[model samples]
Target chain A: MQGLTAHFGGITWAFVLDLFTDYGLFLVSALGLYVLMSAGQVSLGHAGMVGIASYSAAVLAVKFHVPFWLSLPLTGCIGMVAGMVYCYLLGWRLSGFYLAIGTFAFGEMMINIWLTSDYLGGAIGFSGIPLLARWPVLLIVLPPIFYALWRIEHSRIGLAFRAIRDNETVAGSMGINVARTKLMAWMIGGFITGLGGCLHAHRVTVITPTEFGIYTSVTMLLAILMGGLRTFWGTVLGAAVIYFGPWLTTTSEPRDRLMFYAALIVILMILRPQGLLASRAAR
Target chain B: MAEYLFEQFLIGISTGAIYAIVAIGYNLVFGVMNVLNLSHGAVMMVGSFGVLLLFYLGIDNFWLAVAFGIALALVTGLLVERIAVRPLKGNWWNIKVATLGAAMFLENFVTRLTDGRPMPYPRPFKPVYYTIVGDFEVSNVQLFLIACSLGLMVAMMLFLRHTTPGKAIRVVAQNPDLAQCVGVNVQQTMVLGFALSAALAGCAGILNAVTFGSTYPFVGQFLGLKGLVILIVAGIGNVRGCLIVALVLGVLESFSVVAGGSQYRDLVAYSALVLTLLVRPHGLFGEEGRTGREI
Candidate 1:
């Protein structure tokens, strides 16, 4: 019994470590999307923001010889600015389905631009990115970020977000600054997504426009949807399922894996449309 | 240079006609159901594949193949409505996500079936070019496509105006509960609406397949998005408005290709959509306060 416990303990540590390194980016993205959805706006273009950051960081680090640490936060700032511009331009005018479509178009445009530009390494992809992120780095970064998000989820701002999400007009009647709250959600969400992108660029050591296409955005949305949009921990669980579930399964081929993933999503949606961990109040 | 631009403009018209057809179908579904069918493009692809399969099976007539393909698309549309749209009727966001899932499923399934290679469409008609005034030439194929698209648009307009089912559909679009109260079969009308929309999309898909001389599984993705853009630009539920906007989009797309390279085609198109959204959130013909919901 003692020998079995020791052997399992050694394997478990390695497995858990690998899981964190592999899924850290997805976890971060899920958190960003959770914030947006919590405010009752769905962004189909979160992956586009992530792509912008990844490319910016990779180019700055590799071409300009910027320090990795500086490049990371710089990418976050760029993401925040981009998000602010996007929200200011379209967030007020569009909501619900229209917003989804507009953001989707934005995502497609980003990928198309990346695909067409030669400086961004256009179809062949940009490679030789320095590996500056790992399990340890994620561990140090993620907990504090999670704590911050948790605090936001419980604060007055969080309460306002929930109110707006439930009904915008009512929230406005209740004296909440609906537009300002929505923009704030976008800003924070964009920064976190950008940070995730920088981590992904360093970890994967290569970046392609294809990696940040509508499919990536859809997958991220699916993760949040499956987990439950109302709670931060639910989003974390969803992100974990998305990143690690396929790895544990026996699906080896890429096509088969996608098929399985899509089928799983359909089944999950039918079985639990409100999500697996929907807050009781929301239900 | 003038002649080349004229030719490009004509080419844009043909392509735009296809976009108009797809957008009309999409607009119809959105009008009646108030839900965007993300799988509409996939349904179009299925139509293309159906026609291609019929041709491969020794159907020598192009129009016959088109008819069978449209029929197949109609059936698929009904299936999608039953499975994806109906189950999540009340929840708008869930319906969108489910339809997206359905889109992915159809696209990936077709991709796997085709082994990830594009299939060349066999041309049934011989290439015959007719020289027009000012030394311009138009092919019989292009003329056929343009004429057919216009004819179908007219037919659709007439159907909606004169037919009993068409009037029923419009009634439902205006108010489903009221339509039901007035003895209209809402379920059947919704199914009919899906069939008609899918039929239009299928026709557009076949026309596109013939125009390009090739078809693939994921071809619908871009066209589907473009159709949505056209629907938005023209104002949702406005058929005539969609036709005009689609043609303008196609012309703009061709001009962008001439100004920049072909790679910037999508960038130009999507940027136009974003700009339009910024300038006019309700679209050109859409009523105020009728941006997304049916009023």
Candidate 2:
């Protein structure tokens, strides 16, 4: 209680900002990620790709002297292209647990390669990525992204992706282009995560490989899981819970925190197996 | 360079055998249950912890430790199924999520209890080596690990094939609905499957502690991940496929370490899994019908 009181100001501000920043971004990204995962293509390593996009934007803005406006979307585009290339290379072959493996490999490979390279600042990682992201920026950027994704989620294309998630063979029988739908989801998911990464990089003003490892991916998954995978807003709620839940709980132990997350995910799955918001089953 | 490479490669194979034992645990649960037991690796960790704690209590006997580890694992398996798994039955994703929770709980509990320190595990076999066929020198412990792992796999197979309970398990693995209909006591079978997997994991944990010299509190994540990767590489529920892939990964990882470096060893394992999955989703020797065999 004393610790909480002592850190009250920072905590309150962080809570509000986290609610806006992390929660908003996670909501935007989860839709895209859910789309891909539902298409029976799991990319466990996408957090790295998200990291790459974020860091790339940061580097371009801070080092290569690119304008923030120019770097942000460009970084996102790079992420999209990488996602496409990744999907093309392994998308068809990916399904079920195997796709999860491929994603994890991609993430691990990217981390290893980046960790060794001096250009991405390697082990020391990237710092001073420029804090161009602000409340106004969030207001301008987040809603549109969320609204766009929400639109997509309700579209026929979205339904097709959901179909694949439910049962690929059946989806194929119904003439849904499983591979193409997956490719699109991957691309879009990458773009959104990249955008989130870019914003995160700018906000933190520093980035490391650890910023985009399995933990980040798991966090995103947890947000989606906790919020309710079925609805877009649920992921937002989940992100808020994770983003600020720690600050609220204020436990100094990282292991305890992780345990909390792990326990939460399990409990959520058991209680609300369809996910927090529950994606309405494709009729 | 040759000597160094050979030593590292040997190390890789031994580590791979440890992973194989854990993979076998995942495969059994998956083969029977059709659900990914994300906690499978944690169970192995529990086994390690159980042995370590018992050993700390002045039980210097290696055999005694191993037996205790196995017994602890069996109990842990049963408890995990009852608490974490059974409640989430009928929901596959829930199983993964629940197991993950249980895993996190056990890992943190162990870490907190052990003060996050690395504890030494007494070697089951001496690290003394002998040159078998001139150029290839292998440690006695390595031989022991390989033999023990193979022996365990074979024993598991024999149990699955010959024993009444084993046949019942096979039936459950092959077809749970039919197995239940035929009065095979599906619930008990599931429990047995969990127990067997945990017991094997316990053995592997002991073997790993022996070879690696010490067990860390956070050992479960790495071990679990390797086992999960092996299971994916072998396909979801193919026991034979998992064993072969485990060995193949072990050998390949050894070669990659020989050619590249140790920092990227995990890189090789995950990449191999990705590549294998791309080429063959059913794994190296997996069949389409091999969904759930152990649970």
Candidate 3:
């Protein structure tokens, strides 16, 4: 009991445990973004993806009484299938700015729907969800997920993703199915990110569309970008930075905080456009 | 009833003209350099706010204030290009995010200064409604807005087509490497492009503040998005198309306010944007964007 309840640095043990849980959840989402970025795809809708899983998990929990553990993989499967289908159908036509804007629009539309829907409790969002995804659950789940992602990062398909990221034309000429590879990235990334979202919803016990918008999505992108763009460790490091940077700075005011983050991002881009973790590619 | 509808149509024209200028701003930089200049909208807001700040500082002449605002916007645009765009050196995503960060930085800086409050705009003259046709009313401000935008648009079209600098912009747009090889000062021309676009944005931003009655820090986010939406729907570089679409959407919005209340007004434009992206991502007149993807 004493070991479990030990405090550190003016922070209580429960807060530390929660912080760990939160960081893990963010890492999962960051890794999802990492997969897509590795394939040179830009999605400004990760918050919406997380929202989808959260709402789906909420409905599953409320309507079907699905257990927490079962719902985790269930939501991920749904996200994977949804991502694959969506990318295969309409995503192939979109490449650069269009893809980014389309995803942004997707996020906006989701927010609109949530705000207007009565079933989802509209703007306020529905609550009273069971907090089944405790820190222990996060601990049990995260290691395997990270290990799997590391394995995937080194796999054959991962190489295809990188090939496409560098240059699609060359990747296509090499007989890699560019569209299919992108779809694979989105699908797998969506799955892991979906789990991240599910864990978040279950932990918070309440989900609101307000918390998931373009700003949040942009912050997610910033977090990952801050860590590093291409490296696997960069994603993890980004999650950590985003999770803890503000807390360490002790910036309590929202306005100051935004300005700080904005300045950091702008300065970082100017100073190290390649991000902190330089890629293996010779500049 | 016909006269009332006509008055509504005129109202639509004024707003549409403003949108046209905003879209043109987007097009100028995009056409010449393939840079999105996402901060274009914030620069727009800065122009109006510049005028407002000067007014508060006791600059009595509105025209002079407007001139100063244009200059301010030009500086902001150049700063954005320098900080957000030039550093990345053609990395699209980094540039996009950086520009967005710059925009966020500017917006918050202003917001912090103002305590996130909306400031009342200062117009050159008080609006006076004239009975143009037996109870059909027209404000001098509206007429001025419509006339000013039309004149600016015509001037821009002529400038881009006739001037040496204009041709240089077109040449640079076609192929920057070739343009450089041909001894055209690419960097200077790019600066000229930003100046031109920023000037237009300044005009639109001030016009927006006048029409909307108040100016706020985040005003650009919504209005800037509308400009981007117009740009996308009109097909990135199509100035004429942008004008037509902006006017048509404005009229549609006017009529929508009549038919379905003001609530559904934004839906008309946003849905159109989404549809265009879904149906034709290249924009209606765009030649498959090379900035984002490969052929």
Candidate 4:
């Protein structure tokens, strides 16, 4: 909702401004959720957790004079631990709806803690982290990340994880270490989500608890749900739609935006219960 | 320090009682229907708003306001089940998302209708403190809240164990298909289950208003999450577990606030859920008695 300014401006600002941030956040967040969900862990709170990571990274870089390179990975590691803990607790036994609730609660807790903590700049968030995520950085990061996600989802490990999601007892009987696979998925999901947060922190140059809360998490889920939860490319497509759809459609009111999203989720779930790309097609 | 600790303990019990009521509703729905009611808290919020509306309309009597609120919550719950949940029955994930949709719709709709202003709910008892044990002072409202909550919980347990409809509900919960074959009317049972759950949540809303003295549209947001955590802590699909866990949460929250600050109160519930779930997935008390419908 916070639109960027283009003072070094002109016609390019309109094209560049909308293209970079709006579409950019949408794409990465969508891709991230898609990959995570395909790996058999649905992160309803990735938005909030990622926001925390990004804000943490940004604050260390700007206020504490920590180097960006040092700050980013450190933020990622923190998120990794958070994700592992979340999984180690709830993920071992819970799946589907229960897992979603736990993750969502964890996300809310993180946001609340961030909002109340003065050291993290409280609700106002931190700003002015160096903008190191540019086209070149995107070019390097996007391909490898996408490739890795693709490779993992196609691997035997991915099959085992999916089997767990489908039915854990059966998978366990088949010799899959459900806990280990789930934990690994959680760590990877958190690590990537943290990476996204770090980049987001640098790109926006400011972070706030408001940015991370339920809305962001819902939006990220929306991206995955709409594009297609199972297919890797579907997530990218879904992200693009969620990111750029409103701007292309209409910017009427905030309520309208919420309505649009709600409508999108309802439609997708009803129309494609197996997700946008049918499971048959994915197989 | 002792006095402060004692005072906070009283506050904690009362607050925890409200959570216990909500958690009980969640436990009932989960126990019977096997579907999580994401809109259970939303229905409770509607109840709080219903009471506020009644109060605004000159129905200032506390009990009268509560009755009005409960009736409204009952109708809302029935309608919610018919429109939002029934379509997604038999599919757990779909049901979860559907309820989430209902929750989103209700939350945003309320926010829009109110222009984001919190609806003020008058406390049943005004701020009046009485010293206890010659040292600590506990608010009368807090004591009343705790008493009423414990009473309601007992009443629920008695009803579930003794009443005809309650037995029917338990039977339906244990085996809906078999219950249906025995002419239990599965659809009607689901409706009743939701209605019963919603009514309890309404009571919780009233009690929460009594404790906090104000009701915001988004109050249920946190309460919903808390209920979910309590559900897990008690072990999903277990009513008795929910009650015990909720009390534990209340006591811990109270002590945490006393030991740290009010801001840290949530840390207690969140941490407890994280820790307990890590150690025991089915919860300390949960023994899965066939969650959801028969596959």
Residue B214 lDDT in candidate 2: 87
Task: Specify the highest-DockQ model's number.
Answer: 1
Residue B112, candidate 2: C-alpha displacement in angstroms: 1.6
For candidate 3, write residues A1-283 as lDDT tens digits.
Answer: 5533342246878887888888887787777778787787778777878888888888888778999889999999977876785576346867766676667666666766776678987868868789888878877888888788788878999899889888888999999999889899989888987898888889888888878877778778887777675667877877787787665544445677777777777888778776667652511
For residues A32-144, could you state the per-residue lDDT of candidate 4 as single tens digits? 55655765677667786687678767767877888766776787787687678767666665666556656776777787788778888876776667877665556666787
lDDT of 2 by residue, A1-283 (tens): 8876665645566667756765566555555566566555666676877777877787788778998777778877887887887788677766655666677777877777777677888778888776777767778878777787789879988788778877777999999988888888888877877777777777778788766777677666666656655656766776777677765554676556666665666667667766656653521
Q: How well is candidate 4 docked (DockQ)?
A: 0.32
| Candidate 1 local lDDT, B1-295, one digit each (tens) | 7777877888889889899999999988877787788889989999999897788789788779888999988888788788888887556666777777777777888787778699999675998989897778888988988898888988998988899999998999889999999999998988888889989888888889988999999989878888988988777889999999999999888888888878888898888888888888887777777656321
Q: What's the distance in Å from true for residue A187, model 2?
A: 2.3
lDDT per residue as tens, model 2, B1-295: 6766677667766777777788888877876777777777777877888887777898888888788888987888888788788887656655766787788777777787887889977777557879866577888877887778788888887888899998987899888999988899988887888888889888887777777788886677777777878777776666777777777787788777667766567677766766776677666776775422222
- Best first by DockQ, ranked: 1, 2, 3, 4
Q: Which CAPRI quality tier does the interface of model 3 achieve?
A: acceptable
- lDDT per residue for candidate 4 within B64-107, as digits (tens), equals 88899999988888877776667654555656666666777676
Model 1 error, position B69 (Å):
1.6
Name the better of 1 and 3 by DockQ. Answer: 1
Please identify which of the two predictions, 1 or 2, would achieve the higher TM-score against the true structure. Answer: 1
RMSD of 2: 3.2
Clashing pairs in 1: none
Candidate 4 docking category? acceptable
lDDT of 4 at A179: 79
